[model samples]
Target: MKAGLSLVACVLVAGGLGAAQDYSVVLPTVDVEGISEQDFTKGYVAPSNVEVNKNGLSIKETPQSIEAVDVQKNRNYGTNDLSSILEGNSGVDASYDTRGDGIKIRGFSVDGGDIYRDGVRDSGQIRRSTANIERVEILKGPASILYGRSQGGGVINLVSKKANFSPLYKLSARAGSWDRYGGMVDVNHVISDTFAVRLTGDYEQGKSWRDGVKYRNKMISPSFVVTNQDGTVSFEAQYTYDDAWRVPDRNPEKSVYDAMGISYNKGFAHNGDFVKDTLHFLRTELNAELVHDINLKWIAGYRKASQDFDNFFAGTYDVNTRMLTQNYAAQQTDNTTLSSTVLLNREFEGERVGHKVSFGYDYSIEKREPRLKYQRGFTASIDPFASSSSWNSARYDRVSTHNKHKAITHGVFIDDLITFDERYHLLIGGRYDWYEFKSTDINQNSRSYKDGAFSPRIGVLYDITPEHTLYASYSKSFAPYGGNGWVGVSTTTNDIQNLAKKQTNEQYEVGLKSEWANKRFMSTVAVYEIRHKNNRYNPDSNDPYLWAQRDEKSRGIELNLLGELAKGVYMRSSVGYMSAKTSGDEVYGYRNGLELENTTHWQGNVFLRYAYNDLWYLEGGVTAYSKRYHYVYNDAAKSAKGAHLPGFVRVDMSAGYKFSKHASMTLAVNNLFDKEYWRSSSRPGDRRSFMSTFVYEF
Candidate 1:
């Protein structure tokens, strides 16, 4: 790790301009002070404001429900990336994808949401690394009006760390439970007053212990930055690569069905004699900005990302009389995306009001190839004990399915923040988007449509006093749909799926932002009502094998508090209450009527931190989840009415000691009570774990 840091520093310095330029450059910066106190107790700081838009706006000033997790707090809580960090927030949840490549947020049908790096869509995919991240921002409520298309719930922004510019070097390493181990290195150099460079990397592996969870990961990134002072024009470029190996589900299909109380016959297969997953991803981005002496400025950026995944699941199920041999199985997907955006900003109304206009386009191409082979149940003497059992009738190999599709999105937007006086301000924004989708598998169903939508945002900031501000906002969101699959007999038809199920969301919010006691403490109290409409779901489809559709609604309220106490102690906490239900009257596929399944009522977290002198610090926190229900098998059966995963509470703690300004050691423990609780209503929870680390920075 030390060698790597040294190498990066040498290279960056070597690239420095021979002589200092009259102008300075614009690059990334970290604001370590704005992070939560609990994080400060963990021996790390983000080193920048870490706010939305990367404009250094304060959380209290941003007209949205925004929260940032500092690098320090991340270490204290044992977080790896967006998923782990968000688990502590009140209104967030995580789920695994079928391919086990990334995590899904909330109860949204998808695995990931729009991602931002320095306020730009860094990458749209959910799979990402935490090493390059300096801090994370969670924006609650409908954001599609501000960003492009997005869910009604919220968005997570990953603030990437920029060049130190101040000349610094750091290295770290660690080995822990499950044979997990890895190292990281970071360095920056100010080639001249105008040029700088930075580099970071990570390598980790572990023999996971979960029944079917074992894997390893490798990630590397290198970046460069050049800027001209007057803070005008700047350029940044980065390349990243990541790879991982995963093993999924070792148990047979029946066990899963039994656990979830889902019906399964002998004809359907769900187990894999052996499963392995390999993934490769490459991403590149370029960003530039031009700021003129006038209040006018221009910002533009472009990004490209590509990934491939391979999966194989094979097993047999027990059918009726004849011992049947059923084979269920194979999938592969290749995804690629390219996007570009440009925006103009300027001040008006004698600098009392301002406006920013942005326009961009995105194109994505996806391919899915699936093949399934099945046969009647069978009982053969052909050694079922073999790793590759005999019942495995790999008949699907002969039939191949090829599917390719492309999606295009174009959008234009303008925002205005108007101030009536130094004490009052108002903000409004509108956006228009057009979408097109085409697929090779769709016959007449495959169609193209154009729709224009204007979502408005209204906000007000009232300065009650120098130390207090009252704010309120209303926002809306609409998300388009992609093509769905269907079963065709002889030839495929272009029955392009209709846009009947477009997702809609809106939020009404009010909050008080305050700084008190000589600015030593800060706090915020916010209340919100969020609603979703035109939701699509498979209703009454209890037959585990059936796919259907229905509509549901989720609404909730949330509260949060953060800041420092006396004597270097800091505290942060939040709580949420939500109720979600399907409308009683709805019709889609099979069943009808309304029920409760996609709603959670309560969630919250409390984090605290304290520093006892320069060498030592202490941190602790707890995240709580409320009870959730799942449809049970045999609703008439005495013990099979409704499956309930009782609410659970987990605690985490960390302690760190600094040897000097440049070195530190820390230890952290998660699930401290060893309480066994389910992380998902459908899966068992993991056991308690521990992690420790040491680092040196120059």
Candidate 2:
């Protein structure tokens, strides 16, 4: 915060000339301190304005719902990961075990493929870090037309930090409960008027409260930018290496769990088992304004990743003999991808109206080996009360997978923003996609699968007032038989034989939005219905095969309030009530609705931060959920009807003080009550913990 102000002060003192002549800048500086917090978002006040133009309109002018949180606000609250950043924004529920995306938005789960970084797909089994993130932008509704192959549930984009003209450096360290310790470094430098570079790195190691569960992460990202009078070009390369001993949580039979009368904190993982993940990412981008009110933007990227997982857990147990049946599985994957996107935007006058139109094309190719090497996993003979020495051994080989897959995708789309009478805005877009999936084995046997579809989106916005807007939209999405990623299918024909064709998704949404307090506060109410296909586990069938529900649907109402509440107080809060159900031969749960398992019926969070003068600040928040169903063998068995995982409320708080212009310290407590609860029927929540951080800037 001080570094930014110092730059502004220098610009004002020098009368807009702060650097060399060739790379000099100009600005009319008057009152940097007098600037209203509502005009921009930093700290707590959410920004009503956004820079990304995928919607082709200003935030308030766009028909879709969007929300963003800057880096400073995330730092002040001690958020360390993507899921942590989404906790209280717009009724989103997020959780991460330092692995995949545990985020749920509007009754839909966001997997690795559903998440994006800087308008590109960054999904995989790798963990996402906030160390190099500038802010998180969430665009709600179906994004298949803008981004390739997505669910009707929206997208989460992590914007990375970039090089700037100003030079700055920051260093920070943290220590916390469960033997957690880590540090981070951020540095930016300008080489010349037209060239700049930035570097960010972080390292962390922690031991969990649960026995034999530990993890480590090391990440580094370097970015460069070239400044041009008409436009700019930027490049970034990031790498992350992570390893952990994780225990995949599985809820025990309700009656069996009750009979043991033991805590759920204990895990079934052995100390020798481990999971390792590595990722390398590279991107180059250009933004240039063309002649005659036209603009062109291009981006090219490459990503390579590998994951090795060894899982072992107790599937069934015999209490009489204390025999634990250890189920084990091993998975290895290596993936490489190359992608590019080109966009052209133009503005012109129509006969009776004005128009802003966008045309873009996206292309990508992916090669993946879901099974890199076949590993022999064994079932171990063990007892809960016995020593670890009794466990069996697991072995792995280096041979490549028999069936490695390759995928190619092509999509082209055009969108237009038409304004009539300068009050009503209409947005219409459509896209066409061609996808091909091929598989090859060591024996030279090969097969290919191809699919194609069209997606469309239409929305209209009316400016009821200058600060208030009403909008409604309809959108459609398409997901190929096995999804977009190459890892989903193999040469084995029967793997996806049941799904001979693609699946479709659709959504309808209506929303109202208003802002006040110099654009410092914004409130929205949205009602939406989402329909899609689902694959669920059903034990009722004689063979116990996975059940398919072709017409699964989710309907919900969401309300959110963000921005400043008073002079020095700010809050971000949201709550929602949703019902997600399946219409099929299999009907389970209460009211014959058989709501989707683990779907959050009601969930919300409230985050507040208050500043006391220039040196002291405090932050706190609460997250809660309503009851949700756990897995049951018989849904219509008549006797087992209202079974659900208990709901919980968790609290988090933090306090920080700026000792000087260049230094600060903060202390935080998470899971304040040490609550006993489960999320998505996965596992018990983390226990209460404390952490303190010290930071220095130069």
Please name the candidate that would achieve the greatest TM-score relative to the true structure. Answer: 2
**For model 2, what is the alpha-carbon lDDT of residue 645?**
77
- lDDT, residue 527, candidate 1: 73
Model 2 residue runs over 4 Å out of place are 1-43, 48-56, 70-81, 88-99, 230-259, 349-352, 372-378, 387-402, 441-445, 482-487, 493-498, 533-549, 585-592, 634-643
- lDDT tens string, model 1, 1-698? 37435533543442243123333333445353233222244322212133454322356656766666665456443446455566646566543333432332233432334566555554333255566666777777777655666666676676665653567577877665666677777776678866777777767666444533455666666666665454344455655555544454322233344543432221122234333333233333332332221121222333343333332332333433323232344444444444444444444455654433333333333232222232223222222223333344433443344445555666766666666666787777777767654555323234344454567778888889978889999988776542111111112323224323456677788888777666666666677766666553333332222233344455556666666667787777767766655552333322222234533467778878787576787888888878754554442332334566677888888788878888887788877897666555434444566777777787
Candidate 2 lDDT for residue 314:
41
Ten contiguous residues with the weakest lDDT in model 1: 482-491
**Candidate 2: tens digits of C-alpha lDDT, residues 100-158:** 65776665666646677666677666556566667777777667888877755677777
Give me the displacement of residue 310 in model 1, in angstroms: 6.1
Worst window of 10 by summed lDDT in candidate 2? 25-34
Best by lDDT: 2
lDDT of each candidate versus the true structure: 0.52, 0.65
What's each prediction's TM-score?
A: 0.78, 0.86
